[model samples]
Target: MQRKRASHYIPTSTMELERLYRLLVLAILVNVVRGRFLPGPWIYAAHATFYGAEDAVATMGGACGYGNLYQSGYGTETTALSSVLFNNGLGCGGCYQIRCVNSKYCYPGSPYITVTATNLCPANWARPTNNGGWCNPPREHFDMSKPAFMKIAFWRAGIVPVAYRRVPCVKQGGIHFNLQGNYWWLLVYITNVGGPGDISKVSVKGSRTGWIPMTRNWGAAFQVFHSFQGQSISFMITAASTRETVIAWNVAPPSWKQGAIYMGGQLG
Candidate 1:
């Protein structure tokens, strides 16, 4: 009889204790609500507590905030998506990550990466006519022209005889160039014209058509500043020459490291 009694008895384990506790709580809940407890309200509350508030905050934040991170050409939703895309370096064609900046507008072919901005105030923002003006539109692009300045500077101080003749062209060296605020300054030593004729007529024509003339030119120097994509600059020298006029050019390479200037004019 003792063995039978022991066999009939079941042990209460830790898990069983938990189960009993839950059941007891359920009974208390059922009595409190009088069998009126509904799962629909609980689920609704849970969802609203998280998702609903999240959506509300996002909308409010967007309205108040100046901008947000997003994919180029897409809004905030796209920005979030691009974070994943760029991290994978997807569709970049094996290019390693160099640098990235957050801006609304992006230049095409710029080595650095960019993030799109979502919102902007019209009065404060300056929009580009073509594409990729910082915070303008068509957001996210690479701009080769945006790099720091590299320059080529030559001086008339030193001289080296070429073919046993003292040449007007003297010491030539290059320096890095930077686009100054609204103007680029260039100094060149030239003969074949008097009164230190201005070369200010020089202009840079981008890959896209259209030319912007130099603002100031004096002392055989030229000053020009225009939006250009590291293209060829045509320097038209308006000297008081009889017939043959001196015209030269300089090609700004795609790589900002190399700056070149061509000085071609026969001094009489």
Candidate 2:
């Protein structure tokens, strides 16, 4: 007598299927509420103006202490944020997606451009807020590079209404640290960061020393007045928005020198 074979399919109870569907829907709703899935609904209104040459030559060595924009990997796709958004250099490295909303000045296809916040667009008290003081308090504005502005609107527009939203940065490689200052005072400029891009805090560790918190010197640079000479250096960087930490082990060798750039592990 042949034994009965077990069924190939296990039937799922209707209650269980309903529960799973509800869970899936809840997960999607959570992501949407957190601004992770759809950022389009979170877009904000702003105005944008352009400055510098078409090649963005004049935008180099900006307020962010990025030195050479090209060398820092920011290139022409960069922007100077208004004081409200700049937050005293803390906004450096943050990325934004901008699109011209003015039909009169918007490009034919209403193209959108992504830019890194690399500088501060200072407020001009000399001009009226509605006139030339576009970066005045409480107003969100972007002073984009000429090349970046042209990507979304006509050059002759001067300024255009725009819609923008914060977005994660997409970088090509690992994070970069440009060493500056002397052995007694170390200034490290962090760049090419991924994810939220902006750093909230930084801690440094050496082969012979424990972790030491570094202060924000200026822009994307951090500083520590302790000597770490002759010891390999590691970094613990905290993201501004998420507060997530990334440890880059042995980012610089013991023989690291000033003006040298070292590549470290990346953040998501």
Candidate 3:
């Protein structure tokens, strides 16, 4: 179960105290009217902006949130995205649903757009006057693709206030496990995680060795001390958002071809 953080605020005046009392009474009355309440996931509201980001095709050393083999222009109309929370490793490869909720730019027929977290937005540490490349801090802000932003509001409008929450990545196929390099020096990239699909930890267990923890090299390719020559390997995949576990037994056999993708089940 998730713990809710406690927050304290200073009271301003008698008017604010009376407003709080009214809100408390209203909450009790609403609960009495409704029976059998169930808690749901939290949804956050924030402002969002747009830019055409091809971060996956980064010329620099920074790896894309996806694997190395990700094509530059394939499915970019929907998938191209960027985020401000890239410092946290868990934020990469995550999915979110954002809807236009406020501001004059939001039209009546706006629909929520689902975007995959791809690149880290540029920080404003250098220029204090900048707004972190359209990412407003202290809130769960998103800097999305042109297609995604247009779906929420008109392109003529620069920014729109939005409400968003983590959602499952509804992809076409199951999770894909890709092996890079040779059998002696193995690097793994697991992709297409479904629900709030931020990978927190990856562990590998070979025939002889116990569970050996893999250090995150970049986005999805976690690295381990490569030693397996012919034995099969199993993997423990930990989902960051829900702390769920999925194990793929013998997903990769020795003599694993470089860039060969093995299909595995995904988190719900």
Candidate 4:
């Protein structure tokens, strides 16, 4: 009778082990290729210009399409701006923290400004022109409001090269829920949000109601007709960028003040 010999495992060398580890990492990255391809913030040499109530036509006809830039433009202290990039154009409602890195027109000090994207940059306004315009040569340009522009650089320095990054809206006191409408109807304006700040949907719950959906009235305002109108309000808000819901428990009391603001922290 012939005896069969058993096969033994071969030890791998250090180099071979390293190669396998590298291969494993590559595989993991390949598996998440879709996420890798997802859109992210990109840098631009935007020529920041000021725009505000003075501008006749914004890309969305003054909707600003995203977060609440209305507060920023109220009377100037809270500056705002617009960008030429598609992600930064009208309806983007994205927030950016911009700093003047290095520019011939940049003043002595380096200043950074966080602004809500509310408009679009005109293709023609890329650089300062002799025709009383200081913007020209489009692409990667920012048409900011006078307030936002002054935050980063002197207005006289018209166009300054800046470094900007997308960041969560600086909701110092978290989210702001503004109550509106009569007791028969429940309405809320979700503002001062962080992250990809634009809101996608909102839902509410009450002592008797499980979860009542709200419709987008306009901009970031949400509305729903429910019997819980004067019974206090608790709602969930979904962020447009992350598609995540933030729970605002009993945010609004039964009183339902028309212009009252309730503070709640964002999803950190």
Candidate 5:
């Protein structure tokens, strides 16, 4: 005699089938809420204008402490955020996807372009907000690099309506810590951070000392007055929006030099 085969269970009654369907739907919803499944990026209304030449030379080393767009790995795809979005330098290093919309100057079927926030587009109190003061308070604006603007709209438009959204930054290699200041004062300009990219809080630890919080010096740079020379240094960085923390262990050695950039571990 052949062994008895196990019957495959299936819902037969209407009530049983409906209950199974409900459970399936609930499981999907739970996964979505838990971020197991991600939705599309949220779109926001804004305006954009170009400020620099095609080479984007003028866009480098602005409000953000990250010097030299090329050396910092930001390249020409960068923007200067208005005060409404710059958020007192906390917005630095955040990435955005922007596209021209509802304008004749918008390129036909133009794909959206991604840019890193590297500077601040200051408000001009002398001009009217609707006229010359595009970066005035209450207005969300992007002062994009010329190359970035040309990707979506004609430069002659001067300013164009744009739809934008925050996106995770995709960076190569690891995070970079550019060491500055003297032995007594240490300033670290962090660059090439992934995930949300913008940093809110930073803490440093030395081989001989406890963890010490660093103050935001400007843009992406953080400063600590205490000296940590002749010891290995570690950093704990927190993301601005998500508050996600990433600890980079022993990022700099005792032989670390000023103006030199050291590679720390990256965040996701």
Candidate 6:
């Protein structure tokens, strides 16, 4: 039997070499092609093929722009202006404005001021459903994935207080109690203050005499009308125990207040 040896075909002319190079490049691209490119796709070109350029531009906002595009308005000066960016670049007309906010159009849904989380507690104890301050939040994004717990300090707009009072809690204990249930709520409070300030993590001990997992009710720094209301969380101890629950709120931050007296009463 005779074996056929593979032949290596080489191009001759410059044109042929270029053509071969192009063909090889095209083949590599074809082999790697899946659906579309990442970071940004060419959806507009596909739309234009079917709907035409003008129609595609009007519908999906012309190419190169961030969002939907609109034409000039009635008046000359007003009409002269380019696109206006709105809704996080959702609506664009003639001109572009970075980070423009339109109060007339309310951004629907829950307004949650997302922040990083802490180790001692679950994510829920971070912030409330509807709560925010007058000034814009410092950072645009809060990455919860890093660190045990994020230290969020909130300060009020104005301030004027001489001798701040600190309230004392009658009983320092977790609020929710389940002798043989799945979940429990921790409600602790603090007293003696005059303005918004920071609060540390509270220690929770179950009736069975084991320290239960407890996190801060609110962020580290927040404005309290008067006394501090710690976070209400659901948690389980290393092992379930039932005797007489004893919980206490300890100022977590400032390290010095590690074992400071808690003036707030504990409730479920």
Q: What RMSD, rounded to one decimal, does every model reach? A: 32.5, 6.9, 11.0, 9.2, 6.5, 25.5
TM-score of 3: 0.71
**Can you rank all candidates by lDDT, best first?**
5, 2, 3, 4, 1, 6
Clash numbers, per candidate:
13, 0, 0, 15, 0, 30
lDDT of 4: 0.60
- Which model, 2 or 5, shows the larger lDDT? 5
Q: Compared with the true structure, what per-residue lDDT tens digits does model 5 show for residues 125-242?
A: 9999899999999999999999999999999999999999888888888899998999799999999998788899999999999999999999999999999889999999988866
Model 4 over residues 1-268: C-alpha lDDT tens digits? 9555568534359888888789999987764432121224647655555665343223223333333345533223232343235333223445677777677566567767776655445344544453434333344556666666766777777667787776765456667787778767877766666666666778988855798999877556678886675566788877666665678888777766776777765743
Off by over 4 Å in 5: 1-40
Predicted structure with the largest lDDT when compared to the true one: 5
Higher-lDDT candidate among 4 and 6?
4
- In model 4, state the lDDT of residue 46: 53
Off by over 4 Å in 6: 1-134, 139-183, 193-197, 219-268
In candidate 3, which residue ranges exceed 4 Å CA deviation? 1-44, 53-64, 67-74, 77-84, 127-133, 136-139, 182-184
TM-score of each: 0.23, 0.86, 0.71, 0.62, 0.86, 0.17
Which ten residues in a row are the worst by lDDT in model 3? 72-81
Instruction: Kindly give the stretch of ten consecutive residues in candidate 6 with the minimal lDDT sum.
Output: 42-51
Write candidate 6's Cα lDDT for 99-121 as tens digits: 11222221233121211111111
Give per-residue CA lDDT, model 2, range 61-150, as digits (tens). 888889889988899999999999999888999999999995698988778999999999999999987899999988899999999999
Question: For model 5, where is the 10-residue window of minimal lDDT?
Answer: 31-40
